[model samples]
Target: MSKISFEGIGEVAATFACEAEVQAGQVVGLTGDGTVGPCESGGRICGVALSSEDGYAAVQIGGLCRVAKTGEEVTPGFAKLSADGTGGMKKDEAGGTEYLVLRVESDGMVIRL
Candidate 1:
């Protein structure tokens, strides 16, 4: 038999219309335009999804979860942000300012909100 390849992805807690393409394990947030995309500063987060899609996608919006890492190692207490204002988590910028991190994980990272 010829070698074959496939992709397996799951759904999330809640389903919402996506303003942009969202990937599994990516940090998602609500945009000012009232659509779910990627988490960014000064924006509200929904949560991480289980799969990647363009239009309508499932969002978790709560609880401990696994998110995509944005080239940054996150510990139990590290703060995170949406990578490039889209999916994926990255370490918050330098500063002890508030609103540093949206979700803090004990082992991994919880989704958006």
Candidate 2:
């Protein structure tokens, strides 16, 4: 997929090789091999996958991006987010990186990474 960029929303995305199949909107992280893959629980988030084909994926690394969520409730505000181990996001009270959640949609939340 091509890199995604928006005029004023500050969206930043880049293409990367994937270790395995990654669906769009799934949270992903850098693997030990430096390839991107679905993030595991507590894994450091690299970005949200915008598109995936073959062994490459377009990952949104910065700015507002929509992503799936776990059963845990998330609201609009600043909150720590981490992978749910199955390509979804969950609130991370344990703390580390904090992302700004702009809105909670029926499908997912819009967050600024």
Best prediction by lDDT: 2
Pairs clashing within candidate 1 = 25-68, 46-113, 47-112, 61-113
Tell me the lDDT of candidate 1.
0.53
Per-residue C-alpha lDDT of model 1 across residues 76-110, encoded as one tens digit per residue: 44463444355655555552121223344443444
Backbone clash total for model 2 is 0
Tens digit of per-residue lDDT, candidate 2, span 13-113: 99999876688878999985647998878877999888899999998888877778876788889988888888878888895478888777666777888
Candidate 2 global CA lDDT score: 0.80
The collision pairs in model 2 are none
Question: Candidate 1: deviation at residue 13, Å?
Answer: 1.9
